[model samples]
Target: MHVLITGAAGFLGQRLVHALAACRELDGQPLSRLTLVDQVEAPAPEIAGVECVARAVDIAAPGALDASLDEHPQVIFHLAAVVSSAAEADLDLGTTVNFEATRALLEGCRARKLSSTRLIMASSVAVYGGDLPDVVEDMTALTPQSSYGTQKAMCELLITDYSRRGLVDGRVLRLPTIVIRPGRPNAAASSFASSILREPLNGEDAVCPVPTDLELFVMSPRRVTEALIHGAEVAGEAFGPSRALMLPGITVSVAEMLEALRETGGEAALARVRHEPDPRIEAIVASWPARFINARARELGFQGDANLRDIVESYLGERD
Candidate 1:
């Protein structure tokens, strides 16, 4: 299988690429070549069976899709996006990257005239917002409040339409706020979810942008990457009606997260987190729903972290 992955330099994208390289096969088919695309040059994966090529290209730029489409990839993972807070701050940039670029990529795939192609999109829980049920189900309507959520919701519809027309075999995975992320914090409102745990474990002080009572739906990077690969393996008939599937994730409050941190890294690590709420970030996160039933995901064989401790432990195991 010839595969293409956009936003290949980002945290999750980078992890997914490495996982694919390590596995060397997807759905029992040998991975022949992988084309990694991003604004910055993606790091090449050294795997024996697969030829990995990293290209620096902004898909939002004109004619970029045309150039990327030359690969004629049988499977495409659209993982690139301007993150939450960044998108909320700059609507134009968000639209360009999240919506326009996504539309352009799907159209480019349509132009390929292939018999069948699998297009997997990395969407988010941000797609659900404003007075949601205690546990959001697969049938829950997408009521996005932020500019970032609006862009993702719009693209989900576009991908669904294209798939219905037989243009591409599209599958959208509505991912949760990935916790215990490595590296420094980014502009995402949910960055604090990882920062509170990651920084504390690393012996650095971290700030909590929301109240201790604030709840969040979260998954680990390892589990989400596995879910991505599982999405590729599932047959189109499995999706049935809609192309979008909300992946299963665990829900925990900030206080619970701190407790988990205490267990993993001790009270010294727990003390490293200081609460100093940022209203702007608080509002953005507040608009998101923190609970989900995700029955569709469970039925589809996607899984999430068992608990907050497992999430923290998993990151520590991977990083340390």
Candidate 2:
């Protein structure tokens, strides 16, 4: 099965491309091609036996995205977006890139009507609102706070409607904040989550953007990638509602995280981190839900590792 992966140059995008390239799950049927699309033409990873196409695709620019959809990929991983903090700061750019661009891609998919294509959307936990109680909340009613959250929630509804109308098979996975991401801080509102761990591991000082008591949801990159693949390959009947699934992730406070780093990476790692909260950032982080139920996906056999330390170890590995 050939696949199209958007946001190919970004952190999780690059890893997903590499993982799928190494995947052998098409029942021994070799993958025919791998199409990597981003705003700019990014470097392609060498995958010896598969056809790979890397293209510069700008969804906001007229006709640019449509031109890149020619390959008729059987499966799609859509991870392209402007982060919440950036989206909030620039409303016009936010709607165009995060919301409208998604619709454009979906419309393109519908227009092409590739019977075999399954669109896997990478949504965020930001779709939900407020600090969740220590217990998980009901997944039915979605109340989003930030403009980014509202956009994602709306897209979720649109994706379901499109799927219901047979436009395409849409599987949306609402993601937890991906922690211990092994790179420089990104535009993501959750960038601080990764910074607290990744920076310390790199032996660099990282400023904690929120207080130690601040809590949020999290998932490892490996788990996030696995969910994307499962969403694409799993049967609709088994999945029932092909709409978004609120993912169950590791929920911990900023303090718990620091403690985790201390236990795992020792005093050196702990010493490298400093506390310095940005009020704007804190407000955004404060508005986001700390955990989600995701019982629907769990019932369908989707699950994550039990420890945050696993996420830490994965990022610390020799491989990127």
Overall lDDT per candidate, in order of appearance:
0.88, 0.79
Model 2 misses residue 140 by how many Å? Answer: 4.1
Q: How far is candidate 2 from the true structure (C-alpha RMSD, Å)?
A: 2.2
Worst 10 residues of 1 by lDDT: 107-116
- Compared with the true structure, the alpha-carbon lDDT of candidate 1 equals 0.88
Worst 10 residues of 2 by lDDT: 131-140
List the candidate 1 regions with Cα displacement exceeding 4 Å.
none
Task: Give per-residue CA lDDT, model 2, range 1-320, as digits (tens).
Answer: 78788888887788788777778444245777888888888567777788788988786776656755666777888888888877888999989888898888888888888645788888887877764565555444677777888888888888887887878878888888887677688766678899988888777888888878888888888888888878887775565655778676878888888888998789999999988878878887877777666678888677775877777777777334
- TM-scores for all candidates? 0.96, 0.92
lDDT of 2: 0.79
Model 2 regions more than 4 Å off: 24-29, 130-140, 318-320
Q: On residues 64-179, what C-alpha lDDT tens digit does candidate 1 reach at each position?
A: 86766877888889999998777988999999999999998888888787437888999988888887887789888889888988999999998888888999989999998888
